[model samples]
Target: MTTDRVNGIARAWWKEAVAYQIYPRSFMDGNGDGIGDLAGITARLDHLSDLGVDVIWLSPHYDSPDRDNGYDIRDYRAVSEKFGSMEEFDALLAGLHARGMKLLVDLVVNHTSDQHAWFAESRASRDAQKRDWYIWADPAPGGGPPNDWPSFFSTPAWSWDEATGQYYLHLFAPEQPDLNWENPAVRGAVWDLMRFWLDKGVDGFRMDVIPFISKTPGFPPIPEGGTPQKHYAEGPHLHDYLREMRTEVLSQYDVMTVGEGNGLDQAQMRRMVDARRGELDMIFQFDVVEFDRGEGGWPRDWTLPEFKAIFARQAASMDAHGWTTVYLANHDTTRPVSRYGDDAPGWRVPSAKALMTLLLTQVGTPFLYQGDEIGMTNFPFTAIAQFDDIAVRNAWARAQKAGTADEAQFLARLNRTSRDHTRTPMQWDGGPGAGFTSGQPWLVINPNAEAVNVAADRADPKGIYDWTRAMIALRHAEPALVYGGYRDLAPNHPALFAYAREIGEGGLCVVLNMAREPQRFALPRAAEPVMASGADLEGREIRLDGWGACICRWS
Candidate 1:
C-alpha cells in the first residue's frame, strides 16, 4: 500500500528520499584524533539509519588545507587524510549502501585550493600550458587588483601573483582560485574527477556554489559602488556548460545532482533543473532562509507576512515541475532552532520538532543537518577568539575596521548567528567532548550537550529524535506529502502559517505558529489529526502552543 502511492513520485529515487547533511570534521572522531573521519562516519551509520534519513549529503572531505573547512579542494579524486584515506572512504560508502542509504559527495568545482596541482601549474608561468586554466589578468593601473569587486570578505576579489606579473581571480578566499570554466582543459578535468567518483559507486553530487563557475568573459570590472554579484554570477555559457556536463558525464550514471545556486531566481532555476534542460536534478536556493539576515548577513527581523510571501513564491516556482532541495540548515547556515525557532530553556526541543514537521511535510527533498534532530543550539561564543570560521572572522574584522558595529554586540551576534553555531562537534552523548571524541575537538562542543543530545533523546521514547523518525516514516508513506500540490491555507494570518498539500484524492493540512505565543487556528473543515509537534488539538477549533505545528487530514 505504501509503495503504491510513493511509487508515483519515486520514479526518481531522490524525489521520495530524505537527505541528511554531514559535516565530517564535527560529526564523530573515530580515531579520537579530534576530528571526524570516514572511519568515524562508517562507525556511526547506525545513528543515521535509525534516524531514518534516506540519503547522506556529505560535505567536502577531499584533500585540502582547511582554508574554508573543505570548501577549498586540493584534490578532487582523493579523500582528505584529515577525514580518512581512499580505503576508509570506500568502506564508508559500502556501509551506507549496506544500510539502504545513498551517498551524495560534495562537488566543489567553482574553485580549487591554491595548492592543487592544476592551480600550481597554472600559476607557474604565463607560457605554461596550464596557465589559462585559471582566470588571470594584468594588474590594474596604479598597481591594484583587477577590479573593485568584493570578495565574500569585502576585499577585492583578485590577488596579485608577483611571479607571473598578473592578478588572478578568486571570488572567495585568495587560497581558493577560481577555475576558468571557459578553458576546455579545466572542464575536462572536472568531468574526469566526477567520473572517478561516480565509477566508485557513489550515488550523487552536491555541487558547491556551482553557479559561480561561469563568469563574464574578459573579467570585466563592476562599477565602484554597484553590486558585483549580478555581473559575475551568471555567464553566457552557464547553461551550455551544464548541458555539456550532462552529455559528457552525468547522463551516463543513475545519480542525482543538486547545485548550490547563488543569485538565481525562478526562471534561472527552471532553466537549470528542468528535465529538458539537461543540467541538474535540483537546486538549493537561499531566498527563503536568507530573508532574515541583517547587516553583514546577521540574523534580523523575520516578519510572518514576509516569510509567508517568500515561501509562497518558492512553492509557486515548483509548480512548473522544477524541483528544489528543502532545508533550513546546512554546513554554512545556523541551526534552525537557534535561527527560526524559540530555544528558550524548556522550549528548544519542541520548537525543533515543529520545524522538522514543517520541513519534512513539504513537497520536495528534505535535508536534515547533523545534530538538528536532537535540537542542537548555538555555541556560547562571547569573543572573536572563539570563532574558527573564515566567514565570521572576515565579517567581524570588516565591521571592526569600519567602526560601525560594537565589539561586544558583534560578538554577541556571532554567538547567536555564526556558522560556527552549527559547526560545533555533534553531541552523540552527554560525555566529555559531547561523546564525539575523547580527544580535544576541532571546535568546542555546545555546552548544552548534556541536556540536548542523541543518546539522551533516544532514551526518551517521545523525544525529538523519535519524533523526527516518525516524521520521516510518515512522509515516506504519504504521496501527498512528496508530490502534492501546495495551497496556502492561511496566507494572511499574522502568526499562523497554514497550508494544504494534495495529490489526487489524498491531502493533508499543516498549520504552524510562527511565534512564541500560543495560537488558535480554525480548521477549514472537520479533520482527523495525523501528527503534531507541541500539543494535540481537542476539536475542529485547534489551539497550538508556542512554536507548535501539526498535520491533519479531512475526514
Candidate 2:
C-alpha cells in the first residue's frame, strides 16, 4: 500500500514534489548587507536540498523600487542590482539544477513599476510610440477619475499624471501601474521577457496577480462604496490572454505554471485549471488564506465553522477538478502558527506541524513557506511608520482619517494581520542577527527567534523541523498521500479535522485537533498510525493532544 508497492501508475515529478517558497529579501544575506541577495540564496541551497524540497519558488527578485516588496517589477529580464548581478543569478540557477532541484521564479507581469523604461516612455507624451503599453485614459469631463474603481490597497485605482494629462490605472499601489494587456505589442513584450528567464534555465513561473490582466473594456464605473473588484478581478479577456501566453511561451517548454487567481470561485477556478481549458496548470486560491478576515457586520469575531466550510469547499473542488495547489502560509499572509493555531503558551511547533499535516494530506501539491518547518511566528510591529507594506499603511491612514472610535485598535489588528508580519527576516539561529544576516536585517527577526530557529530545531529530533520532514517523507512514500482520491472524514467532529485519501489498492487517513484541548476519536479499525505530531497517541482510540495531528495507513 506504499508508493513503492503500487503498480502501473504514471508519476509526474511535480505531483510528488514538495516546494519551498523563499521571500528573497528576508531569506538570508551573505554579503553583510541588510538585504538578502541571489548569492545568499545560493549559499542556502544546501539547506533547501536537505529539507527534501524538489523546487525552490523564489519570490520576485527582479529590478524594483521595493514598492509592494518587489511585486512592482521595473525590469523583468534582469535581476535587481540591489539583489545581485546576472552572473550571481546564473550561478544560483546552475547550482540548483546541479543538485537535481528546480527553480520557480516569480512572474509579475500583471503590472510594472512606474519607473520601468516602458512606463517612463509611455508616459512621456500623449502620442509616444509606447503610449498604449499601459492603461491610460483622459479624465471625465468633471475633472475626476475616468471610473469609480477603488484600489485594492484603499485609494482611487486611477492616478492622474499631470505630465501626460491622463489617468493611469493601478489596481494595487500607485507605484505599480497596470499593464495594457489589450495591446498585442505589450503582450509580445511580456512573452519576450518570459522567454529571457526561460532561456536562463528557470524551470517554471509563479505568475503573480494573473487574474487581473484582463479588465472590462470601456472603464465602466462601479457604484460608490461597491466592490470594484467584482468588475475587474477576473475580467472578460483573462482566458484569451492566458491561452495566448500558453501558446507563445508556456507550451514551448515543459514547465509548470501556477496562476494566482485571487478572487476566483469554484466554477471559475475549474475553467482556469482544467486541462481542457488551456489556461493554467494550477491556481493558488485565497479562500482558505482569508479565513481569519472577519465577515461583514461582525469583523472581529472568529468563526471556526466558516473556516472549516471554506476548507471543505476548496478541497472538494480540487478533488472534483483532479488537481490544485495547497498552502497554509506564504510571503503575503501571516504565519500559519500565529494566525490559525495557538501562538500562546509556546505551542507553535505542534500547531505548525498540525496545520501542515492537515494541508499536505489534501489532494494537491503542497507549498511550504520558508521558516514554516521551524515554526516561525509573526513579527510584532509597534508603530505604523515601521510598517513597509503599502496596504497596511493605507488601511491605517483610512481608519485614522475616518476618526473611528477604535482607530488605534484597528491599526494594531492591521499590524498583526498584515502581510508585513510574514515579510520579516527568517530565523536561522540564536546567533547575532538570527543567522539571517551578518549586518542589520531588512526587517526585524521575530522575538522568539532564540527559541525557534533552524539550528536549534535541526538539533532536536522531536522538533517541528523533524516532524515536517517525516510528514513530507510520508507523502513521498505513500501512494495514498500522493495520487490518491480525497474525501472529508468526520465532518461533524467539531474539534477534530479528518480526511481520507484512497489510492487504487491502498488508503490513508489524516486527523488533526485544531483546538488546544485534547480530543479523542475512534479510528477506523483497519488504520494504523504512521506519523504523528507528538511521540504518544495516548490511546488505541486515537486521542490527539492539544494542536496534535496524525497520519494513518489502512490496508
Which candidate ranks first by TM-score, i.e. highest?
1
**Positional deviation of residue 387's Cα in model 1 after best superposition, in angstroms:** 0.3
For lDDT, the strongest prediction is 1
lDDT against true structure, model 1: 0.85
Predicted candidate 1 versus true structure: per-residue lDDT over 1-555, tens digit per residue? 133333244347888899999999999899988999989899999999998998998999999999999999888888899998999999999999999999999998889999999888998899988999999998777878776767875557899898989998888999998999999988998999999999999999998888788888666777665455556666889999999999999989989899876877777877898876789989887886678877756677767788777767777786444688788898887888887888888888778888888889876788899999999988878677888999877776777788885878888777666888889999999889888998989998888998888899999987999999999999998878878878898888888889888876569989988787999888878888998876577778778888888889967
Expressed as tens digits, the lDDT of each residue in 63-94 for candidate 2 is 89877888898888778887899999999999
Model 2 is weakest, by summed lDDT over 10 consecutive residues, at 1-10
Q: How much is the lDDT of residue 399 in candidate 2?
A: 67
* Candidate 2, residue 166: how far the Cα is off, in Å: 1.2
Estimate the TM-score for candidate 2: 0.94
Candidate models: Cα lDDT each:
0.85, 0.81
lDDT of 2: 0.81
